[model samples]
Target chain A: MSLTTDDVNKIAYLARLGINAKDTASYTENLSDMLKLVEQMSSIDTDNVTPMAHPLDTIQRLRPDKIIEDNQRDHFQSIAPQTEEGLYLVPKVLD
Target chain B: MTMHTKTLKQLSQGLQTGEYSSQELTLAYLNRIQQYSALNSFISVTEAQAIAAAKQADALLTAGNAPLLTGIPMAHKDIFCTQGVKTSCGSKMLDNFIAPYNATVVDNLNAAGMVSLGKLNMDEFAMGSSNETSFYGTAYNPWADNTVPGGSSGGSAAAVAARLIPAATGTDTGGSIRQPAAFCGITGLKPTYGRVSRYGMIAYASSLDQGGPMTQTAEDAALMLQAMAGFDPKDSTSAQQDVPNYSTNLNNSLQDLKIGLPKEFFDEGLNNDMATAIETAVNEYKQMGAEIIEVSMPHLKLAIPAYYVIAPAECSANLQRMDGVRFGHRCDNPEDLNDLYIRSRGEGFGTEVKRRILVGTYALSAGYYDAHYIKAQKIRRLITEDFTKALESVDVIMGPVTPTPAFGIGEKTADPIEMYLADIYTIAINLAGLPAMSIPAGFIDNKPVGLQIIGNYFAEAKLLNVAHQYQQVTNWHQQTPKGFE
Candidate 1:
């Protein structure tokens, strides 16, 4: 499963990386080589195998879903690139 | 005394006796930093803050209130968050990012009264094996200026090896700590997955990323580990177990202990020099009354494939928090919402980072998830089971840390596959989520070979004892890189 140029463009778009057509050839080549290497898993017999998510196979202990801590919205927003009215401001999407 | 040559014990002893103030020790290291600027080991040095903390520690000591590690100077890999300090993680994404809080390990170390030397350089987001991927610059091996220092913890290993600091903290995802320590001729350990809290330590692969110590000897690693390990409520994955006295078992004899030699680890592609050094070290253990047995880990071949998928897949999600909006570098021109994402990420991330994000995106993309991402997770279980079987027969597993000694700068940079192959021996340990260490076993062609000692989960104390006993009988750990002295 080699990545086509269209696939590279779509992946870059999803990843939010600005990969243009000029560099798509190189990206395609590199991604394909890496995928080829990763593709070795296809030959393995994993029919009865269960996927292990955590290193230690244990269910995560969850804390009660409660807002115990105070929200320092103003303090946190002080470091944002562009924030106004306690909201992160980006370019207008609908406009 | 130079503080660089002094072990943690010696530094602690000096602090207790009032031989020199913590300020003086920090100054000694700072002076060394100025002298060894060519090595490019440190990313940021908080001279004023370090001195102020040292002075405060001295006051506490004079008032008969000193902790176990009062005033000892050490540095952290830039990956660990330090309150109000710029924790760059050696990437441009967080170049201007000042962490609002200290990582759990940093808070614990500060509580123990250790002084922060600075933030050490590392590969960008702790991704690459060599420090070459760092946005700041590549870290030079103080041992041989021409060769590369192994990464992504190259800066910490180089700093310790060059005697710039007594010890430093490092993170090992896939041999980031051990390989660098091997190349720089020092001691480095990666504790079991949950042994150390990852809270505030920037996540690479949450499951595999473990914070440990890189020091001059196994004893120093034990002392440092005492402060680093603990369960933290903030990090959900942190184990809620008591951290044992790692130093207490330092004097335990390795006699009658069983060491496992994995047949696959010693097979083809294993460099003759590294193989010889490992075998010689095993023979030394035998002479010391230890039994060696052959072990097998059949899933070894799938480790790199499994790791590439799982690590990148996790990394993609982990790094999403680094977008331009929060804090750090942001692009000037933005066309729209999509442009903001593209421009910010493109300008912020380094080449290796972008490469990983691309690979990760494809793996987790629609129609390919089962073939790549999920299958890798399935194989991860097989690798862990292999270790469990191996450990049932032996006290610890021993092998070479890397196939070859440190290579020259730009030697394999152009060929990414070649560079990835360098991490083959170390990645398996991360896959199994086991505790492992790289101790200076012997030298090959004037370069050092690290004898990797791996233990089952939560077996750091046993691994340290094995390395410590080896150090007692052998002087290999004492060898310093040339010109460092």
Candidate 2:
């Protein structure tokens, strides 16, 4: 039920976030407290119970394979940090 | 009387009778927003755009073709995207982001002819109970200085309470709408999940997120709901059911109405003053020929834990789009793709946001997936079943909106678990996907408390009727903070 320092690092890395070096100890404590809260669910045994993913319990609605969305690439890219020739510019993925 | 004190219906009639033009009314509210700038209620006031919209509305009025809300001025909770306007979800991450298109709710309000005053302030990513987490600043409660206008819809509630604007739009994933309404002494309704479109509204937790109205009276709330509700194919989760005219049954008699008081809501954690005020309000329901019965929702206490898991999990996935390369805040320089994402998200999100993303990531992480996430989902089913069974016997369930009246700003920030408990009363209804409301019930030590009414799924009209009948006899909702008047 407790999150060690390493756990916080791994979780933050998995979430693609960099934890402030100075705030790591505080993050560890906070996440540990939250886990304590979440751990309360262990009191009840929910074996064989159906997991509810939606409030209404309805299946995802399906539509035919067709493109109904209008292309707004230019408008969308207008707010991007880096875009060139209609492609979003990102750092190199490979050396 | 000055225009700000009038309700939406009153303002609508004024526009129809030519007593006041939309421009005049909009100008009055704009000035009031300026007057109360110390309240930190509004994030952006689109002065030129509001004036232009007012002029067009006046032309419609002159031609005898004005809609119900043609000239009325209100604001959004900043979470809803508005075209060409900044849609900061109270975060530094989206501080520079401008939405290219309007959210469905925004478009709906525009089509209804409601002139938007501007965007309101809120907790970053709708994560916190108090507005202190806002990147801009906290919104002060108009009722009492230093007290929080309970959030994440804190600004909307305070603005309406101060008569700066008649009403505004607010979203509730948990208690974001109802809790603030209770604290600010206004009427707010969170309709059944999917009752309103979420196409342009920023996502918090998709399954639990819903948009509703924050107004002074249930009638005004009904009028706002009429404009904002209905099906939108764009939102896959939007209800396919039709939105009934919410205002049509405002006068429905409460005779023989079966009301249930959930015993769990009145337990030890509730403030004594809150209990006294809620019960006194229930007595008024009895006076109106309604019957009250006690009901128990045993799994009620599980809501907060279940929510911490589900909400953050959903938020983690939803907020993953905030990478440096796209629409939101980006880092200065990136060594590589991983560096861009890490620094951008790290520097972009606030502490509370980072904590949630971390919690959510851990919950959905490889080893802990079934034990944490699945266990929480099964617990969600139990809590939903509790509400379903309780509602089968009662017309509606009544309770206090919060454990106590609004707390002083920065009161519960240090301890996050203590802050999470503020949602104890309001979170379960969302788990059930039922429509619920919070109407001004009474005051405690000069602070306001709201009476919560939870109804069966899609019972917005009945909830409004119940709240409207109470407003008929009591004048609590009519009480305005002294200095503001």
Candidate 3:
């Protein structure tokens, strides 16, 4: 399917990516071309086929709830763009 | 002695025999890295850490016994996190990010006593086919400066090809390792899905990503694999099965080996020169008592489209963690949370990355999810089944690593689809989650071509042996670029 400017804008919003107004036309064209390539999948009939997730067909392994990781909050937060009081600081949303 | 031309075994022997020391080897490599800066192979040359590690390796060497990779100077693809060093993954997003911990693969290599020279450059977030997408800048091929060295493992392959380092680590998701290895005339293996831990290796397409070795020979690749491949509890998807002694089977005979050549791989899409090289390599296998048979992969053509959908869809999800609040790039003075995310991502990600994120978002979005994402997954299963059916009668599958040898740097950048089609032969194997490798087969117009060997799941040892047997009778892997020699 061809992606229009509106479609590109909507998808960029969903992806949380800012497409500069200048680059939107190019983005739309590129995404449309990629979609055209992806459109080849329609040629095959996959009605009975089961969608595969992991290549090995293995289920995600889970471990019991326990704190195996040491608290490195300080070291981790030290690399953040902004952090205060042991939490990442982002622009105010609720306020 | 030309230290850079030495094989892993030769280097190991030199260290043990007291003819050379790891410290000297690392210093030599550091000097060479500087000399070859025009190639843009390295992202960060960890000179101080490398010397310190080499001194430690010398101590180990004096202590009598160390791993095969001990005292060896190598580099990790920037995609792998190295503690206390920048792990950019070739994107502006993580340019300032220093990984707090080493990836499991890095830990594995370190424990093997390998001295890490530094991290090599790669396509941004492992997104592009060529290193041009790298924020660090384009990496040049050692063989021909005008052509790409194949990517996102371009730097790893280029450095090894240029003999800047004896070997390096590379990850493959959709031909990253093999293609570059081919372009740069080296050996690269992508172990079976989950055969190696993904704990520290950055995720691209989770199911398709596998970390292996990029080396000068299959034997070296096998030796490196011995260290890198194993089950890791840290990576849930890491296989629970034991990693075989890959080095042990390097001399195994290929007698009566039932080799399968997929018709799809030999079709018109393949360039004449590459096809001739692959055919000649396959003939060499036949001369070694291997039986060749033609196999059909009816669904092979669909790989590119399916890969485009699934990889991007998964990448969109995987890259979400890169928001401004995290350790990655943050834009200045964001008005609010949404603006912080959009602007940070827009400014941080390159053109190709943004394009993929957008594509992925469209695929996974409402109403179109099944049409694109689910359909791709279904097609993935079909491609895997085709491999299974073909492998039922063959010991291994052989094909060309790329349709053509390395193209000029900006040759295909104008059109993204053209670049995506370059991965047709290699993507099917990743989609099937099988083990594969690309060994230097021959040169086409001075640019190296790779012979791809694929095997069933968990067949890394067998694949390495296959490439090893070929290398035993061939010198393609030993060929270095003119100035490099």
Candidate 4:
């Protein structure tokens, strides 16, 4: 289970991280080394084992849909990198 | 006694009796933090804010309506949101991000009138075993300057050990709190998963991450944990179980207490001196009337691999929200949204964080999901069952916190596998959602070794009891570093 440079690039793209050509070699080496360690799990027989997501075998607790929190849009937007009139401004998507 | 040298219990008593005001105590800690600035323990010191909170605590004391922790100053790991304070999570990405609201842990402690000194440093997004991964430089172990303070809670552990503050809050995903506590010669607890509310505490791995106390003694950790643990409506995963008074059981007799020594923990990987230190502590437990039994955890060897897969996979999902638009670090100039996301994250995150995110993304990618994520989950179940079976036989499991004492800085940074293996003995408890604590047992080559006591799910009181009892018979927890003292 080794990651090629291309695989590292693709994974980086999916993860929304940029990797230049030089760094991709290091990423490939590190990710491949990690994958090698992870591959140790493949030998175990987990045919009957249940996949444990949470530590406790509990389901996610649901809450009433009613509004419990007041609107703090302005307060939140104050910390945004680019905001105007409580609207976060990102690069143009439809352009 | 110097205010910095006093325990949380003593500080509380002093404040209540008017021997010293909260203002005076907060000043003492702030002064110490400044004096010991080279340890790199604190990321941000809230001098003005701490003094203001101290003034409020004094007012509460005057009104005779103060909480147990009123006026006692401490630090929170930067992972917890601190309202107006910078919550960096020891990452460059969040270096400029000021939290809009308090984390539930911070709010709970603040409501108790506990004065926070500031935010302690940690591994970037809590990724590394060594503090070297911190965007801020490594927090040096106060005991040995060249040795690394075990982390991602290294800064918290080092601060507590250095007596910059009596205690500080720390989080553990894979031995972050306990390992650092072990390295720094302090007591740290990792309560059961969901024991403390995670609301506003930056998430690293939702399922395995838990916040706990790092302090001089298990008794202080008990007091801190009592305030920090409970259900919060804000955190959906917060357990609804009734919070127990952890301090009440501290003096409980260990008579006939069953302690399980897992056969796997004492394997060849454990260093000779660490094994000796752990054995010495076990002997002390035996003398105190604990009945020791050998227990076996067959899947214990697989904990590191299982944890790496699961924790990073979860981190990958949790960190996706850190796109430059809403908050956190953004590039100066971006050509487009995709460019914004890529460059901001790539440039903002440290090497270790990026590596984990990459591995996680690869693991969760279309073809590899079953082989990596699902298989890891199943292994996690096996590890949990192994703990369950062992705990059914004994009241607690005792082992060495780390394979050895703190290693020198940069010794293992180049090898990710070596760094990951540093957590082998501690990661299984998180996977099982059990409560565990690390107490300073003794020294190996002038560095402290920790004895880890692991309890059943929600048995934090029992774990604290075991640690507190051990602390009672030994003065290891009281030993401070040379210059810090």
Please write out the lDDT profile of model 1 over residues B417-466, one tens digit for every residue: 67887788899899888999999988878887899999998989999999
Residue B326 CA error for candidate 3 (Å)? 1.8
- Taking all chains together, the TM-score of candidate 4 against the true structure is 0.99
Error of 2 at B351 (Å): 0.6
lDDT of 1: 0.90
lDDT of 4 at B21: 97
lDDT of 4 by residue, B1-485 (tens): 57788899998999998999999999988999999999999999999999999999999998896888999999999999999889999998999999999999999999989999999988899988878899999999999968899899999999999999999999999999999999999999999999999999899999999999999989999899999999998998999999999999999999999999999999999998899999999999999999999999999988988888899999999999999889999997899989999999988998899988988888898988999899999999999999999999999999999998999998998888898987989999999888899999999999999999999999999998899998889999999889887
After superposing candidate 1 on the true structure, give the runs of residues whose Cα lies further than 4 Å from its correct spot: A65-68
What do the candidate models score in CA lDDT, each in turn? 0.90, 0.93, 0.92, 0.92
Q: Looking at model 3, give its docking quality level.
A: high
Question: What is model 1's interface RMSD?
Answer: 1.2
- Per residue, candidate 2 scores C-alpha lDDT tens digits across A26-90 of 99999999989999999899997899999987777888999998999999999999999999999
DockQ, cand. 4: 0.90
DockQ-based CAPRI category assigned to the predicted complex of candidate 4: high
Which tens-of-lDDT digit does each residue in B290-316 have in candidate 2? 999999999999899999999999999
The C-alpha stretches of model 2 lying farther than 4 A from their native spots are: none
lDDT of 3 by residue, A30-70 (tens): 99999999999999899999999879887789989999999
Q: Candidate 4 — which residues are off by over 4 angstroms?
A: none
Score residue B366 of candidate 2 by CA lDDT: 91
Worst 10 residues of 1 chain B by lDDT: B1-10
Q: Write the per-residue lDDT of candidate 3 for residues B361-475, one digit (tens) a residue.
A: 8899888899999999999999999999999999899999999999999999999899999999999999999999999999999999999999998988899889999998999
Question: Which residue pairs show collisions in model 4?
Answer: none
